[model samples]
Target: MKRAALVPEFTVPSPERLPDMWPGREVELDGLKAYVRDTPAAAPGAEPAVYVHGLGGSSTNWTDLAGVLAGRLDGQAIDLPGFGYSDPARSYSLAAMASHIVRWVEHSGRGPVHLFGNSMGGAAVVVAAALRPDLVRSLTLISPAMPFLDPRRSLQGPIVPLLLLPNAAKLAARRMSSMEPEALASMVIESCYADPTRYPEQRRLEAIEEARRRHLVPWYAEAYVGSLRGLVSSFLRAYLPGEGSMWKMAARIKAPTLVIAGRQDRLVDIRTAPQVARLIPDSRLMMLEGVGHVAQMEVPRTVARAVFGMLDELQEDKAGRAATQQVATQVRDGVRQRAPRVRMAS
Candidate 1:
């Protein structure tokens, strides 16, 4: 395939240059508000890459990374049902969230796509690609949640996991509901950062503002717990015997894959990242130093370079395989010609 010059990577923009929010609108798919990235010129037929954010996160997570890849491919980041400004489904499960993603991709008429997922979103895309390989061309997973049960922290502090106990969902929701939006945002900003002080001040305000917007949703608290519960349940099932296992889903995925994580990641442990890379055949792993859980957000340009490198390698592998097949065909034809001719008996 002919190509345009690839997008330049690793040019980390100043906070002043980074948009507080990307231009977008909520798309109604099956009556759910699927907010997606609408800027950054996308090349036609280049296969759009869909972005899925982690638990308690929305499509806004892809803001920086999408800009880095905008020139090379079309991009869209979904606010997966109930997390962003989206409406809730009757039930929220890992499988159902993944299905919602699949439906959105199918509905958009963009298949064999370059799929990107972060944290819990990583698990969602794994399931989506496993269930419908035809819809994915490649997968880029950043700190995917694959069952590390050290729920010592739940974005707030060490005791948040205790809220998961039986008959605790409502109480947890009520307590979380009572906290100010800034307080919640501050906890997230603190937990996700390797140096909490370094994450830009303007972005901090944007995050707090984003949190305030979410607080306006009638069921935001319930949805948050529901999403968390679903992720924990998924972690437990990842080890079980069946097609449901995350390992099994990962093994079943046919798309070329990339797994990346930060050495200083506190939310999802870096140790678990390699286990995912080892389970998924032919996948690549890149562990960044001095980075945290949200690698894309913290160092968008660097992550873009890694993704660009992966795509370049994937293309080369395809070309090499094609050449090998052509050579084998030539060799077979030569053998046929060199073989002794059979005598006709009559």
Candidate 2:
């Protein structure tokens, strides 16, 4: 049974600055440079969580939420190969990305982690959990992109899924390359948040700076388009047998899962979250009324509360199992001590 939600004892953070978030450090995962969240003083044996970001998002997306959960979870948000500061690999398929993360979790010996993701990364984690259930202990998805399942909204730029076609995708990539980071970031904010103006000025400025940094990378646009294609491709394979599908994979997950979606989310349809929650056997779905795409970033305190609640449930369940095992052991020991001794004919 799920435990009562914890009342997180903290104020909701204003928009965060880069320096305030965990610094980026290079790490090797899948033989590629995987930039990850670096926290020098994370508590030992705290529940380890691996955070993944969406299309056009980097590990930096977890800045606020990770900080809030730091007391309870030792979090490492990864820059997925080709996005954020990570180097790109040849393959950009959803399965390939998920496999890379699976490798990272196993190689780093951080398995059975609480897997947290947003947008495209959210979909990737779902695939990872399905592929390597041993690696994921729980899943928390924020506006996971169900590309095939998501309908195109006008506020978002030209339908990118169809843009994935050869000529169109190339044209889209070129256009994005020419666009300024400020413009790009502003566009993202308008599309992502229900009320972008509601975001703090300092945070908005930091995001603009982040966009500028992203523009400096020659392959940034390529990475964004590749992620969009990967998401679309994954959506196409959802019901196919033996193929990696998020919906199909969700059914196979054995861990406790929490899915949070913003009622005003414009990217992946808000309707998708409920079905996702329904698919995962032991999952909880929480919808924030006035929130948008990035719930973890926009409402860290509330999101942290949900995470703590999941942790509470996990702890209780673990204790119960341990008690059962101890009782069984005791009963076996008592039977052995009290049993009558019979000598067999020699």
Candidate 3:
């Protein structure tokens, strides 16, 4: 592919430089709003990458990573329906979300993309990839919520249902809002990290503020409940034996994959990393020490490096195989010519 010359640096007017709240144009569906960041490339076959964020997160969560990836490949960061700038559909389920993603990828003319997902989004991507392997070139999952039967350790096992209990989640949100910002932030920190103090105070405050703002919205509780129900139902379905779960889907995935996690993630224990690695045949695992649930957010460069390293390895392996095949073809042709001469003499 021909590369375009880099644009010269220049200052922009305030109006031009200002960020758009939704970042990109909205893809409207009945009763739902989907936001997308579409970066057009000057050349063809640039390879498209799509990123999906986790629960309680918006497309903005991937701002840093998306920028890095977009520079490397034509890419988009999507606000999954019911999260971030996206509004909820009448029926919010994992299947529905996955289906929406599939439609969006197809609609974008970027079917079969390099797919990236975090937490719950990771699970959704995994299911989607398994169901539509032809639409995925590769996968990168960060702290994916895989199904676990152990209730004591898994965060999704218990809290998911609680969040789905009709109006119960709204009541809890109301109560949570009443607490002091520092106290609420600390509570969230305790659940998300091994050591809350390791995280910067400003980042923690930002998280608290985001949560507070989300809670204040009237429809927030309904959205939360619907999403939680979908997550929990998917988790349960994935845990079942034989045919219908994530475990089954994991074994079906043919795409090269990278699974990343933080050793100190309190919500989803790091122990699940090896299991995920083992389940996905073509997958590699990377675990970072002293990090928490949001490893990419906490260490963007590190995450980017790990992801890019995997891509490099995959490329190298492909090139090596091609070279080996070429050499083998040459040797076979030489043997064929030699055999023809010997038969002529005979």
Candidate 4:
């Protein structure tokens, strides 16, 4: 049986911005708003990194990681359609989200980019990279929601969608709203972190306050349902083996890959990490002990190091390959030039 806590032990912080910390370009399209930040490439040939967030999450979830990664490489993070400040769309699916990312990449004119995602967002990166290998130079997945047979162990499978059900979701929202801001904040931390005590009280309160405000919107139920439906459907399709599922496509991924998982995650079990590492041929896995579902949020520095480390490796690999090709071409040209001289001497 799964363990359930009646009350959270820590205090939640109030929701307030620290000012210009998460400032970025805001693009509005089809009623959705995408918050994008661009960090120029550190080196002429360095590829930019693009980040996508998971379900019920906003780009803010990646604020810390983005700031750290931006210093090392060109980076960007966006709120997927219908989540965060982004407006709702008619449909939500991994493929649909991947398509949106492709457009974003093309519009940014960043050339090829390194991709990173958490949970559902991680799955989206995988699908996007598979669809357009030329546009993606490498991939870093933090607790990617791949195919899993056990529904009880996967948050994306059933529990999330159940919470999104019209009446049930509204009831849940109401219940959460009724709690004190501090209590609500504590609940959010409990759900988000394996060790909620590690998070600052202010951050937790801010998250709870945001949830409280969102609950007041009349169409919040509709948005919740749409988002959950898309996630559950995608989760199903990605898990079925021999179904041309996303897991099957993982083998086709040629980009250097890095998958990070939190051993203490209650939402998506850590057992999925090794399988993911095995499927992607050129991939490595980094499991963090005493962490939860949102490792990026829970331990930003560690996540940043693992993710940027992979980006560095990819850059080095590309440089090495380019040099090898250049040398091979020169050697071939020299052999051709000497062929006629050798024939005449003979």
In order, the Cα lDDT scores of the candidates are 0.79, 0.78, 0.71, 0.71
- Model 2 clashing residue pairs (backbone): none
Instruction: Give all candidate RMSDs, comma-separated.
Output: 4.6, 3.2, 7.1, 7.3
**Cα lDDT for residue 24, model 2?**
79
Q: Estimate, for each residue in 1-346, the C-alpha lDDT of model 1 and write its tens digit.
A: 1111223543433344766577777788987667676545555545478999998888888888887677666888888777787787776778988999899899889777899999889999999999999999899899898777666533433645654677565665677678798898998877777777767777788888888886677676667677777877888888789778888888888788888888888888678778888878768888888988898888887788778877878789899999999999999999999999889999
Error of 2 at 72 (Å): 1.3
lDDT per residue, candidate 3, 1-346, as tens digits?
0111112223111122312322577886544567786654324656788888877676756655555444455768898776666776666687777787787788777778989888878888988898899999889888887766566665545665566456776676677667876676677667666566766655666667766666556666566677767777776787667576778888889998888888977666577766777888888788888887776666655677666666667678899999999999999999988885334554
| Total backbone collisions for each predicted model | 1, 0, 3, 9
Best by lDDT: 1
The estimated TM-scores of all candidates read 0.86, 0.89, 0.79, 0.82
Model 4 segments more than 4 A misplaced: 1-20, 30-32, 38-46, 154-176, 179-181, 216-218, 238-244, 342-346
Which numbered prediction scores highest in TM-score against the true structure? Answer: 2
How well does candidate 1 match the true structure in TM-score terms? 0.86
Error of 4 at 190 (Å): 1.4
Give a tens-digit lDDT track for model 2, residues 282-304: 88888899999999878778888
Greater-lDDT candidate between 1 and 3 = 1
- What tens-digit string does per-residue lDDT give for candidate 4 at 83-202? 666666566767788888887888778858888889878887888888889988778888887766576775444556465455875665666557776675566578768898888655
Q: Regarding lDDT, does 1 or 2 come out ahead?
A: 1
Q: List the residue pairs that clash in candidate 1.
A: 112-135
Candidate number with the higher TM-score (1 or 2): 2
In candidate 1, stretches whose alpha carbon ends up further than 4 angstroms from where it belongs are 1-16, 42-45, 152-169, 322-346
**lDDT (0-100) at residue 210 of candidate 3?**
61
For candidate 1, give the lDDT of residue 203: 79
